[model samples]
Target: MTTIPRISLSGTNYEIGYSHGSSLKAQIARQIEFYYGMFQYSSKLDREGVHSRARDYEATILKLVPNLHQEIVGIAEGAEVDVLDIVALNVRSEIALGEFQDGCTSLSWKVTGEDGKTVQYLAQNWDWVRPVQQNLALVEIQQAEKPTIKMVTEAGIIGKIGYNSASVGVLLNALRAPPTDTTKLPVHVLLRLCLESRTAAEALSQIEKYGAASAQHILLADLSGAQCLELSPIKHHYIYPNSDNFLAHTNHPIENIAIMEPSQFPGSKERLERTYKLVETMSSKNISTKQLREMIFADGENGNFGICAPEDMCKPKWFRTMTLFNIVTCLKDGEPTAEVVFYNGSTDWIDPQNVVTL
Candidate 1:
């Protein structure tokens, strides 16, 4: 029998990363790149103008992994054939990538294939003081042997990776920088590029290196508190032991390394404020995961900000989603089984392995 790469999260010990399926990397990448291309690689967003930011993403990738193009570019090229078709395939629910902030503290998991396995890690959240900015964030550690789960995303590769083995996926809105020759090297090209890896690290490397798009953060977590690094072109890494109980993220580029640059964006502030508000609610003694779900899905109008796109996201033809989530198989042996919820209000979603065991 073939031991395929099935992404199941069971108390941090078990299988993850590349599953036995048809081009897991390409399937993941096509979903993202095609959407960007369909929308012509632009969003109705203001602040953090992305067209110019594309260059920054390219530069950052070059610095992070200079030889990435040779390793994963082929996957990106193959996916291009059906990117447009695939983008049009699914519009029922947009792909989202994230984890419950509270559920993912201090968990570890591993993903194995024909090659050696890689560990996915998580510590408590922290704060960061970058060269020009500062913020609070959670901490996670993992390596990339085409890292199967623990990794950082590149610029312009919006919603970058971590979706190959789980139902959770994230699609980002590119705030590209200016001075771009948008004629040939648009950012949409990179989304397809990112989906070409079996691990989070591999996807991250692909996006960062070949990323021609502009800037956006790409941090995703599975249900077990396993996290990935999302290095934006303009980063502002934060420190740990913050107060987010439920899994959450904003525009802030979080890194504990202290070498990241400062990020400047109104969206980052807004998302941070929103995250703080969530933390407050979760920290309450009475708050439960159900309430946390409500908070995530809460909104003022019928179109709930609860799992909604940013208020400024007005592009009718863009990758619009509320409460984007990605569940990876990054759990180590000591954590709990992974599960997720949708609309930030549903019951926890258990993986198939847990279901079978139950």
Candidate 2:
């Protein structure tokens, strides 16, 4: 593959969604196919069942964020697919539950510079099955009232891993434990809401208000600082950076919350530990983006299941997960100082990969 498609969208919510859907119609179909296969293999849920769950989420989103709902509608119309299909893609986390596991490591580091300014960074390795790798898209949305969003998401899904013009960024890790409540907004929709916010606090408020449909870990950071929201269907928890001024999250929950479904990915714990161990070697106050990149690219004994997961052919299709892409965003203290880097291609950090800087 050359590089992931980079799409720039600007207009009303429906127009933006229409552009996204029409521009990526083929990729969106492929995304639907991939998710359908995963749903069947992981949870025994057919397309009908997935759409059934999606309908409830559609109603909830329409009730809560109507403009976003319009966007979803536009996507369906533009893609020439049912609206529920896009909704199914958006709410895949809640629908899959613990049956389908996604392995991702998220990190946030905040350092006080010599000039009494704070240098904050948010980064993640988006790990998933290999088949969907080619379906991923880098989407930038320019909305009317909300801040502009630049996110890397699966073709049909609107909300995902990305940062906004306001310096508010979000990283997602799907949790295994869950009692999914279809009455609330799904995690992906909540992610879009967070990205629309001007600050991390506003994002938190949105989560608290709409609540989550299932369990998810959302690592949120802004110009001020960073905080991890460990959201369960019923209750939520927060994880802050340690005294070292750095925080890392894997697939497991750091707080003492009830886990209904045991995690299938055993390497989550190891990856979290490994990330911390790697951070130990870097200076907290002077951590550079290069150091952060090295941290995500650290692949060793946990090859098939490391922080940078590599696909294992021996494993079943659903179990074959690898790092799809990596994104790192830095919010500094000056004009035009904000930095966003996206890495796509081979896991080898030394390889000549497609790197995009914005």
Candidate 3:
């Protein structure tokens, strides 16, 4: 079975990070190299420039979530890399802004069972440059006084797409926009903060208070329902599921207020519309996790820019992006059930052995 490495971590924030770094030292180094190259190619920034931006983001992280800052410090110590390198990894989205077009399709489905129980499912197809897929790690974090978090992130990044024991799950869609706020929490850090919250409301409240550093869309869902937080440096908006009880998002900004560059990924609109149509047709029936996976894996509508992007689909092969993984979290009564399918160079293949349940 082809699978991504899964690391289980428990203890203080620093200890969790230390374990992550020590266990995945080589992967972290690879992530740094990948991002450094991406920084230069996408944002035209050198390593020194990237480090300078990372230092500014570091101050914001310290002020907002000092514990996470300590975790980052511990990661650097355990990995034997400079703290700035990890910091740069965490804030790579902010530094690059809209230059690197990493496309994704995210959705949240809320349905009520015949027994009057409500269940919410949050899922996404994480598309990115193929090389970084090797560095992906499924990290399970057990912290004191916070929800247990199971997330998939690049080796050095402290925060990313994941859910918690509190039944809150978040899916990310990177928006290609400018004007990042250095004083505010970076988008990835905000994702970690949301995972720490016990409820969706608490996550939204915390995000509003800390503010967002970049323009991105976070599709946040709980057992109750879900809301898409369309966040930018200057403004933010919340988009809930439709009357049919589901919402979908892609790389483009849904709201017109924010200034965003034209998406380099061509099929954001096509994918978003296609996802809506897929769910609408299934509204009369039960939506299973397997069904959701099928919907996410549907391809060829826009060829290379389809929902399940293929590497050869993009011209100038260096810019090719492919789905690295598809994670679906179903939040019900006792616990939230989640599964991740780590891509193995095929769009529609979902081997049972490749699925990791959390």
Q: Model 2 off-target regions past 4 Å?
A: 112-117, 335-347, 350-353
- TM-scores, all models, native as reference: 0.40, 0.93, 0.95
Candidate structures ordered by TM-score, highest first: 3, 2, 1
Question: What is model 1's C-alpha RMSD?
Answer: 13.0
Candidate 2 scores a C-alpha RMSD against the true structure in Å of: 2.2
Evaluate model 2: give its lDDT. Answer: 0.80
Which runs in model 1 stand beyond 4 Å of their true positions?
Answer: 1-71, 74-215, 218-239, 243-249, 252-271, 284-314, 319-321, 324-337, 341-358
State the C-alpha lDDT per candidate. Answer: 0.30, 0.80, 0.84
What is residue 208's positional error in candidate 3, in angstroms?
0.7
Give me the displacement of residue 97 in model 1, in angstroms. Answer: 19
lDDT of 3 by residue, 209-313 (tens): 999998889999887789999998888988888887888999888874774665444788889988877776665246677777875555546766777767765
For residues 1-358, could you state the per-residue lDDT of candidate 1 as single tens digits?
1112223211111111111012344444534444344334334312223223333433433454433322223223333433222222221011111110111111122223122433332212111111001110111212234322222222112223333333222333322122222222233334433433544445455555544322333343333333333433333232223333233454434453422323343344454455455555443343322333344433222232322332224423333323322222323333322222211222332223322110
Clashes of each: 65, 0, 0
